[model samples]
Each structure stands twice: as structure tokens, then as C-alpha cells.
Target: MNRPAARLLTFQLPLAAFLVFLLFPFYWMLVTALKPNRDLYNLTVNPLWTWTPTLDHVRRLLWDTHFLPWMRNTLVISVGATALSLAASLLAAYAIGRLRFRGSGVLGITIFLTYLVPPVILFIPLSRIVSALGLWDRPAALVLTYPTFLVPFCVWLLLGYFRTLPRELEDCARVDGASRFQVMRYVTFPLALPGILSCLIFAFTLSWNEYLYALVFLSSTDQKTVPVGLATELVTGDVFQWGPLMAGALLGSVPVAVAYSFFVEHYVAALTGALKE
Candidate 1:
């Protein structure tokens, strides 16, 4: 074979296959959402394509379910959690990664170790804490609880990123008599933007898709996140509502998809930087 043809087979064909593999779920969801009930249920019909398309499922998902409220709750919780976690993680990472202190290394490792602990093991105690705080069935509960996992990972990532930053710049600022807080606010924070953006994306995505904590803490239909709401509200026992379910799933994924699209470069750069440390 010609070199150009060989290169095409080696790279382009695999790239195309990988793209299809990643995107097939989305295409299936779109096709299912658009499929008419008759075609959706008909055993003889092609599952991959529908001749007749309808927006009925989308309409049903929007109007018939508490999807909008769920979305709002999810957005509020996700943003709140991400903001809170980032603030805490930033301070913690800066202190551990930059400041010279005893036990800082041990503290950093401990924080990252906390992230490895499974959420399933923590939810029961967290549920009680949420209830005791009278935050049950409220978005604030998730806003608080999500930070448990988010902070540790964010701290770990930011710690690595902070280590990669030039310490000499910070020393120069210090020599100029800039206070620690001022130095961070002016020098380190701006340089750490990529790592911060990566943490924001990770925290937001985790909070957005979290299910167990949402299910345990939020009892109201209006208070649930998309993941919990879609699973519990869309299905009626053994029976499933595939069309509306798929529609809801597709709609629910858009914000996260948009977020990744916008910040993906920073996310990649941050991960690469962190891994180097």
C-alpha cells in the first residue's frame, strides 16, 4: 500500500472508530427520544432509526415531569458545591504546596486519601448529618455534602499544580513586602487558573451527576438532581418510559457537555501539569 494510504488506515480509521464509539450512545438517545411510541414499541422496527419522528417525549419530559425544578436544583447545588470546594481546596492546596510547615506533606496525602474512600460508605452518616441540620429535602444538603468528595480531589490536583508553579515568582512578590493573601490573590491565583478551571469542571460534573447522596438527602421531586430524578421519577416499577427517559437523559447532559467543550483545553493542561508533579 502507498504510505499515505497506510497512514490513513493507521490513524484516521481508528480515530473515526473511536469517535463513533464515544458518540454512539448520544445518537441512540436522540433517535430514541425522537421515535414515535408505535415505532418505539414495535419489535419489527429498526432500533437505530425511526421513519417517523416526534417531539412528544421531549414535551412530556418538560411539562409532565419536575425536570425543570430538578435541573435548577442540580445547577444550584453543583455551582454551590464547586465554589465551596474550590475555595477550601485552594487554601489547603496553597498552604500545603507552597508554605513551609510541619506535617504539610502528611496532610496533603491524607486529604487525597479521603477522596479514595467510597461515597457509599459515607452516605449513611451524611444522611443523618443532613437531617440533623434540617437540610433534608433541600439543595443545600447536597451543596454541603458534595464537598466531602470534591475538596479532597480538588486539593490533590491543585496541590500538584501549585508545586509545578515557579516558587521564585512567589518569593519575588514576598520580597516586595506583599502579604501572603495578596501574593496568592495576585501572583499564584492567576497562574493557577488552568488548574482551578479543571477542578471547577470536575466538581461541577460530579455534583451534577451524583445520585446516592441526592437520593438520600432529597425526598421532594423538586429538590432532586437530574441523575436521581430521572431514575426514580421516570420509571414506574418494572415498566420503563424509554422515550421520555432518553429525552431527559439527553437534556440533562447538555450543560456538562458544554462545560467540558469550553474548558477542555485547560482541563487537559491541568491534568498534564499535575501528573508531571
Candidate 2:
């Protein structure tokens, strides 16, 4: 084979295998979501594909459970936490990347270090703080707690993006009598749109998919987010509601997929540019 053909042959097999491995779970979920329990368990039928598709699982998950409220709570907490994280990250990234302050390197490392700490370790102290603040069993608890990790990660991401920009732009804006905040608002932010969107997407995804914090912070049925809600409510002791569980899992992943699809180009470009710098 020619070199190009040999390279194509080399890449395609692994790519196809990787794609199948990654996508099989989603495919299984989709199939199971539409399959009746009879076909799902029947040894006679093909497990990979469903011959008879039904919306029963989807209908039951939607109407027979607290799915909508869980989705709403997840949305609210994710958006709130993303917004808060982005605001803080933008400021922190700018300061560390451009301000040239004393101990700024140490401070940035310290901030990023906080992100590395396991949530399992921090939740005990956080739970007490949440309870003391009267936020337990409420959506507000998640919105507040999510930022502890989100902001650090977002700041680290934005800091790399911020470092890639030309300092002269901010300097020129400053020379024009623009204050630091004014320069950030009028100059830096517009140029860093891709990075900002990337941070927003990351922070939102983290908040939306978080399970431990949601489980620990929220106790009420109405307050639980999608991940916690589906796992806890769909499984009754030893019995698992496989149909509705698969249905809920499929539905729960839709928002993050849509969000990623919308921002994927910008996110890719941001990472590329940051890496190039």
C-alpha cells in the first residue's frame, strides 16, 4: 500500500474501535429506553438492537416521577454556579495572568491546588457550612458549593487563555485613561470570548453532572438534581427500575450534549490558541 493508504488504514481501525467503545453506552441506553422489559431480558432477542420500540419508559420517567423538577433544579444550579464561577475566574485569571502582583504565582498555584483536593474530603466541612447557612436541602446549597471547585478550575483555564493575549492592548487602553475594570470590560473580555465560553461550558457541565455534593446537600425529593434524583429514586432497595432508569439517564445527558455542540468550535479554538501560546 502507498504511505497515505497505509496511514489511513492504521488510523481508521483504532478510531472505529474507540468510537464504538465510547458510544456503546449511549447506544445501549437509547435502545433500553425504547425497549420493553420483555425484550430487554429475553435471551432470544438481540441485546444490541430492539425490534419493538416503545415510549413507555420515557413517558413513565417524565410523568410518573419528579424528573422535570430535577431537571429544573439542575439547570438553575448549573447556570447560577457557571455564572458565578465565570465572574470570579475572569477576575482571578486577569489578575494572575496580567497584574504582576506580589506572590501572584504562589496565589495562582494555591488556587489551582484547591481544585485538586478531593470533593469527598471537603464535603464534611462544606456540609456543616451549608447546614449552618440554612442551605441544606435547598438548591441554593448546590449553587454555592459548586463554585468552590468550579472557580479554581475555571480560573486555571482562563489564566492560560489570558496569557495568550497581547499585553499591549490592555496597556494602550490604560494609556487612554481607561481604568483596570474598564479595560477588562471594553478590551480584554471581547478578545477572550472563546475562553470565556469554554469556561462557562466547563463550569456548567461540572455543576450539572455533580453527584456527591448534590446528594450530600440536598435531602428533599423536590430539591434533588438529575444525577442524584435518577440514581436514588429509580432504585428501590434491591430492585432497580431499569427501563425508566435508562430513560432518565438518556434524557439527563441531552442538555450537556446540546451545550457542547453549540460551543464546541469555540472551545476547540480556545484550547488550540492557548496551547499555541
Q: Tell me, what's the RMSD of every candidate? A: 1.9, 2.1
| Candidate 1 lDDT | 0.90
| Per-model TM against the reference | 0.92, 0.92
Q: Write the per-residue lDDT of candidate 2 for residues 49-92, one digit (tens) a residue.
A: 88789999999999999999999999999999888888888888
lDDT tens per residue, model 1, 108-152:
889888988999999998888998999989888988888999999
Tell me the RMSD of model 2 versus the true structure.
2.1
Cα error of candidate 2 at position 254, Å:
0.6
**Lowest summed lDDT over 10 consecutive residues: which window, candidate 1?**
268-277
Runs in model 2 deviating more than 4 A are: 1-9, 269-277
TM-score of 2: 0.92
